[model samples]
Target: MKFLRPALLGLLSLAYPPLVYLGLGHFEPRWMALPLAGMAVVRAVATRERVWLAAAVGALALAASSMLGNHALPLKLYPVLVNTVLLAVFATSLAYPPSVIERLARLREPELPASGVTYTRRVTQVWCGFFVLNGGIALFTAIGASDETWALYNGLISYVLMGVLFAVEWVVRQQVRARHVHG
Candidate 1:
């Protein structure tokens, strides 16, 4: 339980860019939008007031991918199909993460507990983690990937921001825990 929120936070954080990358970078053969859409759906099902918001976000992400795929040139069917597959994956992942998240949610869950803001914050960390990992891979992969400025920039910004936030939270948590123990 204690380790749950931190871990879930990492997972949720992963949602942001994979969604953004699919729409903006035009980089993947297989739409990597699954995780983002999954997170949105998970949020919807898990919460009462925000289900619509989550579902809408999930739909909009898929829509954006569809639009991007169909927007110009030869109107490729690949992107559209990819979007469908990604949506399916999102659905699958969303169904399962809850069991894991709920277990983690059960831990301490102080005053604010694991609400929307907490989830979002954690997801941001996961998002940043993805950027760091992907960016590092890209940075070292070869000349072409390494040379791409947009890849480096996008990855770096998310990674740095998330890293800073995580560090700050960790430090604060440590201080509070120390005070609780000492006082």
Candidate 2:
């Protein structure tokens, strides 16, 4: 069930550009944003976490903007808005002890070594940079590029980049852990 939401979301994102271009045109913005926003709200209500609440608020704001008839703005900015929120989360975690990645690492292995802490912090910083770059590119695409271009980046390229980053990091992390365990 948890995986279902993101799978559906991925499907919607993949379909959005063509739907807008060939089917919906520029009039019905609510159809593009409301369902995602509604899901965000539901997730927020279920989790009751501040982060989820923030996402819900962002989605609701997008939905509201769509209702006001600024067609291009809502659909175009959704990815940018979501990335900005993610950027905030990753960047802010660096401001205090135990960055978000470190906390997750701790969950997996409670007795995190000193080197592990440093590594997680560095990984957190890398994620912060990724979010910044991702959000900037997304914003630029939304503003200057066509809808097809925007959807291509947001729906496909962005996810590919993120998956590559995650895969590389996982491989590196395992190697580091193995070395630590051996020596």
lDDT of each: 0.43, 0.78
**Candidate 2 segments exceeding 4 Å error:** 1-23
Model 1, 1-183: lDDT tens per residue? 666644663455443333344444564422444444454465454446443454446454654564566431111222222233334333433454543223443465534334533453454445344444544543333223332343344335535665886687667667755765677
Q: How much is 17 displaced in model 1, in angstroms?
A: 4.7
lDDT of 2 by residue, 1-183 (tens): 877766765576556545554434645666766665665666566566687678778877877787677465676777787788887887788897789999999998899999999999999999989988998988988889887788788877998999999999999999999999998
Instruction: Name the candidate that leads on TM-score.
Output: 2
RMSD of 2: 2.8
**Residue 87, candidate 2: how far off, in angstroms?**
1.6
lDDT of 2: 0.78
The residue pairs in collision within model 2 are none
Clashes of each: 6, 0
